[model samples]
Target: MCGVGGIFFKSAEHGAKTGEIAYRILDGIYRRGPDSTGVALWHDNADGLLYVGVNCEAPGGGGRILEALDQLGTVKQATDGDGYIRAAIAYGGSEEDLVDAIDALDPAITVSSVGRHLEVLKHMGGVANLDAKFDLKSYDGRLAMGLTRYATESRIDFTNGQPLSARAVPGLAVMHNGHITNYHHLRSSYALKGYNFSTQNDSEVIPIMLIDEMSKGATFEDALNITVDKLDGCFTYIAVTDDCFAVVKDAYAAKPTVVAENDEFVALSSDPQSLREGVLSDIEVWEPGAGEVHVWQM
Candidate 1:
């Protein structure tokens, strides 16, 4: 089992406290999957452009990928953690251009998500490791989502981590719980479409499929429905973007998902303990319906 959780906030309304709120929400679920933890936050500047990035793994190969990116543009900030690395690039270019540059820099370097207000990153390790390594507390953003993973398929190292992102689809990142039995078949299908696979974990297949559907002009809701229909297994998945956030449970509903929200904010997690510890001390919490797809927009 894995622990997944996220929060969607009206950045304009919450203003500066958004990052703190997001962090607390993520911190709540640290016990669910202590193997690794990561977060994605979204926010807009006065210019109205979105800023997004994630904290995740740096393929089997090391700093060569990051060094190449630094050569192309300026590497704003970079930090090394146990089995992971977190970095930021200050590029005055399009997200697509930056993503292309990152990919070109190293085939292993992938953009987890991009949006007017979101960025995400994740990799194998404890929350403390990610925090000390990345200095996450100082990060500033609007809305954010994070995950702590205990791998079921791939190795329990940096390669198999959560907050898997869909770079091809701007502003999309996913965290999943449970297994996708038909993952091999799905992986082959996407491979034929030119989407490469990295980690052997089934969760990696999610972003590729989501990006493919989005490329075909599917809305987040549409993509969610299609994903539930296509993937064969028991799962509870969460996806976040600059403008929206969604949670979908498989048809069989074998996995658990609880949602808590009020006028100020909305939070979701695999269990209530995290919500209680990380978010609000006293809040109403309810389990989502079976085959349910919950969406929140900022």
Candidate 2:
């Protein structure tokens, strides 16, 4: 089993801290997923720099990455966290080329996200370990999603964690609970089309399929709606783009999903206690109907 949570601030003035709340939510659901935890955050970036998230474990990987990125453009800021590196680069270049260049640095290197407003961070172990390394409490953003993963099929590693993003679709990230029944079939189809997946986990397919649909000119919401029909499984997923936040459940709603909302923000989690613990205490919480989709745009 896995635990997923999302928080979308209704206004920047809400005075909400994304990282602190994300910690509470994931910690509340720690028992459900004690193996690993991750988070994807979106914030306003007026500087026009692309935020690139890469997983690199090679010796001197940080220096190598900076050297390579400087060859293309100026790297404004880059920070290391465990095995991940988040860099802000001012470059007018193809996202594919940037990611490919980074991935070629080492066999262990994988680009998790490249976007204007998105930063994906994950680590094996508990939420505290993740916070110790990335300092999650300092992040203040418009929307963010957190996940605590319990490995069922894939190996328990940094790259196999949730909150996976599509390398081809910048500013898009997904966190899911439950399993995808048609994962292998979908993986084969997408792989045959030259799509590269960084992990063997089934949840990784969610973002890949969404990227495929969005590439065909479907809006983010339309792509998600189409995904609901194409995927055969019992799952509840939350997704975010540059301007939107979405939550979706399978037709049967076999996985648990609870939501809480108020004038300031909206929150979702696999456990209701997580909502109460991370969000508001005296607010009402509800569940979406089977196959239901809820989206909020900024």
Specify the highest-TM-score model's number: 2
lDDT of 1 at 28: 66
Residue 247 lDDT, candidate 1, scale 0-100 = 91
What lDDT is obtained when candidate 2 is compared to the true structure? 0.85
Q: List the residue pairs that clash in candidate 2.
A: none
- Per residue, candidate 1 scores C-alpha lDDT tens digits across 110-218 of 5555555555556556555665666556655546677888777887765567777754456677889989999999999888988866567798888788778977999
- The root-mean-square deviation over C-alpha atoms between each candidate and the true structure, in angstroms, is 3.2, 1.5
Q: How high is the CA lDDT of each candidate model?
A: 0.69, 0.85
On residues 206-242, what C-alpha lDDT tens digit does candidate 2 reach at each position?
Answer: 9999989988999888888887898998889999888
Give the top-scoring candidate (lDDT): 2
| Per-residue error (Å), model 1, residue 133 | 1.9
Give the range of the ten consecutive residues with the poorest summed lDDT in model 2. Answer: 54-63
Model 2 residue-pair collision total: 0
